[model samples]
Target: MVSKHTLLSNDLFGDLNPKDWPISLADLPPGSALVGGSVRDGLLNKLSQKPDLDFVIPIEAIKFSKNLSKRINATFIKLDKKRDIARLVINGWTLDFARQVGKNLEDDLLRRDFRINAIALKLSKKPEIFDPIGGMDDLKNKKIVAISEKNLIDDPLRILRGFRLMCELDFELEKKTQIFLKNNVDKLSNVAPERIKMEILKIAHSNWNSSVWPTYLELQLLKKWNEDKLPNLELKRKDIFSTKPIAGVFLAKLICLLSDEGLSSLKFSKNEIKRCKNLRFWVRKINNLGLDNFSEDERFQLHVDLEEDLPSLILFLNDKYANVWLKRWEDPSDPLFHPSSPLSGHSLQKALEIRSGPFLGELMRHLSKEKAYRRFFTNHEALEVARKWTLENSPFL
Candidate 1:
């Protein structure tokens, strides 16, 4: 039986219902409670952007997690079996499960990494707010303070996590917390590379205009994390974070700005590394060619290479490069820059008597380049142009 505590109203938490949650009142383990993010976000009025919900139960966390995962038809992933931490993921739903580290809510909250993340509400019909570490007050103050020094020592990942939270919530880290973060920066090296990569990517993908690099630099975390790949703090550009959340191209740009070797150490995916390398290649090519020297075909190829990334790339470059891109596309509807190709593979095959194979693909690329360079206006004209080009280029013709 659950009691309805009006103060801990489920209504305030937009998506935090028993049906939507990992476990319902009937299935909730004894002494299980809704803790951390879900409760904090509800009070903070960040219902929409909250990522995942957290729950703590006294023992049986893994068994309960597996059972709840079965109930919700979610994927049960054991985060730390020894520590009794598990995760359930199903579509948009994510719930983290952990056993209470101490005897009660106070002890659990005290053992948490930060005060702003320690508040909780019991899992009952009659729920009540249980905040023992002044988390509510710290949250209201927009302050991020560690629960205790031992907490940071216990998990060095919290140092990185604290900076991430500061960026996410735009909060100020307490002075003592800052000292502790700086001192234990070395422990971050002991953290799993994948864990470190995830945090870095989160910082990139966030709407936080502020750079975590600054925080990392302050704590020497950046130097420690960099090892040798990002040797120069001045050159390891951190301005890639912006009001615009990091999407594909932006993320690639960030990776390029940060050294390839640094990303390798952090264990970014092969695809991510490849994209970043391509982006760097494009940047170098653009610099070497200059705005005026780049032919229309060359510029078009650059745009195609950087797909869905023109505006961002244009903005990120120096004044000269940015101006060149702006000048190139001043007429947004310019025929030379139009995405539609005037010729098709089938059209070329029929007109040029070319078989549908490697030759056809080559013609398509050729015609597409001509289209960007404004060599032909219509499909018929493009076919004629292709016919001439094939006669000149083909050995047997």
Candidate 2:
């Protein structure tokens, strides 16, 4: 609601400092302007150490991107030829250039998904902030406001992206924007699976809270994709963030929310799908039959199966067991936690004169389990146990 337009250049230039960019802005075209996240971040003064930059130009973006890559010695990639979108990678910074979507910069900015993301800075000797949509006002108020409902409907991935921004910036979604998102949640299926998967992980990696969980549930975001009902657990915990290999935390939380069918529909890798499936299987088993009821062999097999991914399961345990298991999992020398056979498969095969087959595989597993549970400590004992087991159970004999 301002009656007339005003030019505000107070601190934006100093905050952004185009002269400090890895690639000088002097090389860009006359009308080239820095837009999107870089502008939004500059306005917030929360720029990353190496911020990604996006630009909109009046003319050929792909050609300009390639020329810039050659000049700056960057890696060039054409993201979309039809749309005249391209990317340049150099010095840990990524720069994307795209053709203007409409007649002018204001039109292009108006076409963006959110007010916070629509602010643009015209790059020049005397740069000025462009706030055709009162985006700066929205940023000041710390709220997410969609440009229009049609924008969200045009690209439903923006629906999830808005929540990710909400988490990253600790901003509240404007009530109307939330309603627009809720209405368009079903259209998310029309978007590409990889794009959806990428946004899902970005949300997982953000600092989410209980409040955001209910919003996601209300939207029924993952309900259609999952084979079963979503996990009802509140995954917020202190140790989850403190644990090493934090990627496992993200993956574990994702699998808890999604099912194998959901993950497959999103085209997750075979290994990831398998790991999540096995983790779900064991989690169900452990929940059904109490952990206290597991036999020694069953416990040994759990460690064996999840030795690499045990960190992912530790959060599911109670405090006492979680602390104990985490301590053991961190210690490489903890025999039961990090199980290994005292004798190698080769040694067992040679000593027992057994060919490499199912029997030999079974012998190695048995020896490894026996060693894991403190049943044997040395190769001599392993050989003795192997000989006795072969005599008693070997099909070849």
Give the number of the best model, judged by lDDT. Answer: 2
Alpha carbon RMSD to native, model 1: 4.8
lDDT of 2 at 288: 81
**C-alpha TM-scores of all predictions:** 0.80, 0.86
Global Cα lDDT for candidate 1: 0.70
Candidate 2 per-residue C-alpha lDDT over 1-397 given as tens digits, one digit per residue, 9 for 90 to 100? 4323323454766677666677887788888888999888977889877778899998899998898898889999999999899999887889899999899999999989999999888876767778799888999899999999999888889988888888678788899999998888888888899998888777766666556767777766676677665345445553355445454655556776578998899988999888887777777777788789999988988898787778677766667577788778889887788888788888888887889888888888888888887887777888999999899997755
Candidate 2 clashing pairs, residues 3+ apart or interchain: none
On residues 219-287, what C-alpha lDDT tens digit does candidate 1 reach at each position?
Answer: 665455443332222222233323333345355335433566777778877877776666666666755
Clashing pairs in 1: 2-125, 3-125, 3-126, 4-125, 4-126
Candidate 1 minimal-lDDT segment of 10 residues: 228-237
Native-to-model Cα distance after best TM-score fit, residue 382 in candidate 1, in Å: 1.2
Which residues of candidate 1, in runs, are more than 4 Å off? 1-15, 49-51, 67-74, 90-92, 210-213, 216-249, 256-258, 285-297, 319-340, 355-362
Question: Which residues of candidate 2, in runs, are more than 4 Å off?
Answer: 1-22, 41-49, 70-75, 90-92, 134-142, 242-245
Residue 303 shift from truth in candidate 1, angstroms: 1.5
Local lDDT at 59 for model 2: 88
